[model samples]
Target: MEYVLVLYIEQALKKGVVQTMEMGLAEMGRVLRQRVLLIVLVTLLAVGLAGAGSFLVLEPEYEATTTLLVQSKQTEKGIAYNDLLTDQKLVTTYGEIFQSRMIAEAVIERLGLDLTEQELLENVRVRSSSESLLTAVTVTDHDPKQAVTIANAMAAVFMENLGRIMQVDNVSILDTAKLTSDVLEPVRPKPYLNMAVALVLGAMAGAGLALLLAFLNNTVQTEAEAEQLLQLPALGAIPFFEQKGSSGYRVVVRQDPRSAVAEAFRTLRTNIQYDEAGKHVKVLIVTSTLAGEGKSMVLANLAVTMAQAGKRVLLIDGDLRKPTLHHVFHLGGQIGLTEVLCEGVAPEEVILPSAAGPDVIPAGAIPANPSELLGSPKLRGLLSDLRIRYDLVLIDSPPLLPVTDGQVLSTLCDGVLFVVRSGEVARDQLQQAKGLLERVGAQVIGAVLNGKQRKRSEPAYSYYAAPEGDPHD
Candidate 1:
């Protein structure tokens, strides 16, 4: 029984190992596909560097070679089999003699070259053929002519000294060393070959590095990740819009109602209107984990969309420290939220109506103590009054993690719409924002994934502003 149990455990362990390896391979493939452009760019850059090094950075070397024939001194015309074997054995011995210090010194002296015996020998190489009585000697140097001179000198010196050293006059020169001066092709630095090798190596390195970075990046980039990490339903994914020319912060519903950006906001509005707490979400606070995440733009668009849907929406710029709703609605920002809360101004007097369908209450003044003001009971009474008057009240608050304003104001609203920028806010920062909302007993109904870039393969509706003619006609 114990043996069977151990066997089962071992089998289970093997299955687990296989499953882990398969999962890791699948993740690697995903990273490779996602970062293909990065890998290609890195590979091209590396190939360029390699080409530069091979052509301009490294020194070129030239090689010259000479061949020597080893034979027997026996004068008999009829050669014995034993004589052939002896010649074959002498071929290897003669090869070693070609690279000997004595030959190197003699060659340097004969050529009048200023080099040590060891240094001269370092450039010389000797090898014998397996099926012949021939030995080849090669010399390499930076100068082509010098390489040829060294090869010829080494061969001559070896021939002169071989008879005295080996007690046999059998070696003879078969071929002389030759030199070629082709500036187009260098022997040592092959630029194309080096670049090709570097291309492959750099691609592998770039892929590995991209995979490592993807693995280490703990950020919410997709809807599933936001839902999984924060345990909140992703209300919508707001596609990224290029803010250029006259298009500032896109109020898509009014500018291009049929475009994808406008369609996305409409989808977001529909999702917000039909969620579990949709009917009860009368006064909702919209804020993100960090600043510059387009949370304010999201709130403005949501409010515009709701009002366009026949709901009376009151848009309040709750971010007194750095307010943007006033600029967004072209209202006076110097006396909006601060005047109503601190100076006892009426809500109806400060509300600015817009053609976008939403009435705005901009953050009028930049108060020194924003957190204290938002936390005051007067602010709560104002929100209550607005909620009673308007069908929907969307408050654009400061970033949750940066200041205590969002967290403090979250308790006064019906629910909090946590906005996270895709590939912007770290997972830890998002988690901290969630934790703060939880600690304050704030109701977080759902989240919005902002600035998601649409894939190139996906259909775009950028030019579809509206229909050409009225259908009623």
Candidate 2:
């Protein structure tokens, strides 16, 4: 039981991370845009740190350099100095005297420093150039005056220590170390260079994080995702329409009647006609996983498209809760479906003619029991009567997952069409909606993607949603 409980907790945490990553990838472009201000602020902060940290943390320490001269005595011919070739042999001895603790201790004592011989040695450096007997000693300290004093003291002590240790007077300081009266500048923390490094590092980090998120994410954001998830052939893609006017609403077959939008609907119409199993599509229902998915608008435009093709299309405003079909056609909602059911009006009579719309039944009043009304026997009978009167019946339903209205109506319809807004409906939510329809045995033919982005690289599928605003789907 404990092992099972631990497994359950681990699964839960994994699910949370997966969900977050999926959401990020699904909205990758929008997420990048949203973080623009944050990226700018981070760059500014890096610059400020580069500038302020450079000035305070750096301390100046001056260095004093002095060279020692040693010449080898050698001659090709007979000479007194030729017999005494001792300068070359004295090089190592001279180098050791400059580095010895005794010489360093004497220098510190003469210069009046309270530091130990080891501490004094830390400030002194002795070395020779390549193939040369010239020894160089350098002393560094916080003040220029003190650095010069230590350098001269160490040089004087090195000569004294060399005569005693090597038993020869072969070493001497060529020049005395002195103070220049000017303070040496500190060298540390280059602000410009630091800022540049930070910029490069920060950009690389951001890019790595973005790629990691993109790879791990699995939410449905593309039209390709919908096609792959449902395993259905894509029918057609409708461009997002902003409003109901000339520029808005892509059902150009209904509005413009001669443009590309009209062309797309005709293509969709052709696909529907070619479906052998779904060829007898009469009473069709359109719905989505959530509201604001443009189900009503798509329904209106599809009906309009069929009507233009010389088919008697009947558009029904089946969303009894929040009826928008009535407003779109500017029709009189004085009496509609509720009145037809209660007042016993003929199904044909409730079907009103529109000025531009083919035929529509406006939702007269807000019904209390929407699911019940849709599930009633009258709805099927009404559909049968309308099927004979009109060539096609288009039923606009509420969101599938939000209510059971679409589910109840689906049983009576010939087939159902699900509308999914790209980037708006989460992958899991759509999966849930699909599961609900399957449980109820609804025949979902294919999905209609409503709003699509303008990006060319984006795959052609149902719809595309961005962070800016609603792409109709």
Candidate 3:
């Protein structure tokens, strides 16, 4: 029984390790996919530079080789095994002598070359195998004819000096270095080979750079990232969309109700309704960590979506300092929330109606003390009165970290729907903003992850889309 239990534990541990590895690979693949364009551009730039250097900057070098045979003096009874062994041993000595400085200088003088002994020796090579008695002399130069001439001269000088230095006449030239019109290809500055190597190295470097950039990025990009950082439930994920020739806020739920963005808003509405089993979120504040995160646009569309579901919804622009809902709904912003809060104007008179099914109350004017006005007792009373009149009241407030207006409004509202735009707000900023709301004892119902990048494999609203010729489309 003990062994069985131990075996079971081992199997479970292996399974857990496998699962962790799979998850890590999946996350890496997602990061690579997100930065594929940057990697491609870097790779192409490297390849271009390599091609230029290979073709335009570097000089080509040509090589020519001559072969020589080293043999022992043959006896009348033919060659013996010991003679062949002696010749093999002599091959090594002959190879070194062929690359000596004396041979290099002699070859340079014989060929009338404009090069020093060391420089000519640097371009010459000698190779011989242990089992063979043949030595090859190779010389490289910028000009093909110079390379051939140097190679043949080096072999001749080595043979003439060998008889005088070692008193041996066993070396003979087997093949002379000959230049031909058909065989003038340079050995160095191989453009195709260099480009291939550069291609591989550049791709590796680009991939590494992309991974480093992904690691350094601290922004919240996906719904999972937002939920993991803020510890908040994701009520809905709205994919990003853009319409040409359209400006200001986009009420996609009202204009193109059959589109994917509209479907996302409707999904958000359904999730909000089902968030709490027996409770309903009546007065909600929609806010983000920073400005331009699309909180106002999200609130406008959410209010319209709720109203489309047979609920009386009121959309209020709660940002007193930088009001934009007036511009969004194309209404005059001279008299709305500020007048009702500071000037004690009646809320019913300033309330405007829109064709998008939601009652709009734009921010009246820029206020010097937005935090004080939002935190007033009269403002609480106004919300309480408005909450009773409408089934759902959605307030678009300013960013939380920039000012205290959103936190103040959170205390007066029934719930807060935090908006997080993909790759816009950092993780620390969202954490700090959520901490501020929590400090005020706000009821954060859930979060709405906006501007999420949709995957290519994931079809957007195609199942609910009407046919091309259909009137609904």
Candidate 4:
């Protein structure tokens, strides 16, 4: 049993870590997909602009090649120049004689060129063919005429310098320098290649950055968030149920079963069980850090679910400033929590049946001092009275911040269940909400994640699996 427990705990912990990383990747994929069209368009535009610019804006330079034959001065040893460098030893003297400043300057002076020795040298190239006694001399320039003139001059000077310095006719120009009849231009700053590579790199960088941001965002973004960021059990999820009622856009949980909205509430009930809470969970308060988080809807649906389980459940719209139970139940706000509190009306008298099966009490008339109303001894006495008559009471109160209504009412319940919508409830909001609940000393029973999607990596609960027959193998 101990081993099993340890293994379970380890699995749960690993799942939490993996879930966080996967969520980050999932968010990255979503972002990439959303901007895929833009990425492609940008890539095409970049490559197109680069290719066009390379072809039109850049002028093509011409190349004039002159070939020279390298023969060995070591005919005495019957060793050929071809047996140098890659063969046995490099003819260091010949190589230096060709690349020297003396030969380069002599060529420049004889040609009456305006280029510096270094600049002129850049245009001249000496190349040796593989395992051969032949060398090729090449000069490239923007002007075709200058290219050919410079090539021929360089060859004459190199040969003269070799004869004068080394006293040998080892280097001979095989082909005199000449113009290419098929005069062509060069391709550099390859815009198409550069732009294509840049665009691709940019896309990869963007995706990688998005993934990093997602991973660093430790706040809960969805049901996957609850399991990953907090490593906590998700009590449930309740969706926004919309239907045409006597009032505009209210939930008909009984009439519209199997809807995505309905499934949310049922899922919430299942998650509640995941917390290992006592089966007799009652007197729950639903609240968030800020207003407009669908806390009331969650409470209403939770109450309905409890009622469906044959429990006498009462839903109280504790948000005295802004009520919703009366509107959802179509009670016209005639009699509700405000009326019962102010006039001392009985709970049974103000109780209204909901289309979803919960008995509800609306906020009634807006209270000038909601904080005082929630803190009053009468509210506590009323809760004490209602607790005996009903199996569960779900109080839908205002947000935790901007008022003390929720914190005050939470004091009258067993625990407060926070409702956070995916991408809607930010990390700071949850932290502040938790801080407030802690300040008020309210028991924060696990959270109910709202509008969360299941992840591919997360294992789905098998609570509602279909009945099946055994198959013979």
Candidate 1 vs 3: which has more lDDT: 3
Tens-digit lDDT track of model 3 for 364-436: 9888899999999998999989988999888999999999999999999889999999988877788899999
Q: Rate the local accuracy (lDDT) of all candidates.
A: 0.83, 0.72, 0.85, 0.69
- Give the number of the best model, judged by TM-score: 3
Q: How close is candidate 3 to the true structure, as a TM-score?
A: 0.85
Can you give the TM-score per candidate against the true fold? 0.83, 0.64, 0.85, 0.65
Give residue 406's lDDT in candidate 1 (0 to 100): 94
Instruction: Supply the global lDDT for candidate 3.
Output: 0.85
In model 3, where do residues sit more than 4 Å from their true spots?
1-23, 39-57, 75-86, 179-182, 193-209, 243-248, 277-279, 462-473
- Best to worst by lDDT, what's the order? 3, 1, 2, 4
Of the two candidates 2 and 3, the one with more favorable lDDT, higher being better, is 3
lDDT of 2 at 292: 86
Candidate 4 lDDT over 42-119, as tens digits, reads 566666666677677876566788777765556667874445553322333454556678978898789777878888
Candidate 4's TM-score reads 0.65
Stretch of 10 with least lDDT, candidate 3: 14-23
Candidate 4: RMSD to truth? 9.1
Write the residue-wise lDDT of candidate 2 on 1-473 in tens digits.
99998898678545532434345554666545544455566656666666666656556567777778776433576445533345655665677777788887788778779889888788777877435667878887777778888888888777777666766665667867754333455323455677788777665555555555544454555566677666655566666666466433344465565444555566777766676535888888989899988888777777777777788988888899998877777777778987776667776666788766579998778778888888888878888888898888888898987898988988888888777776577666777888888888988788767675546454554442232355664
On the 0 to 100 scale, the lDDT of residue 283 in model 3 is 90
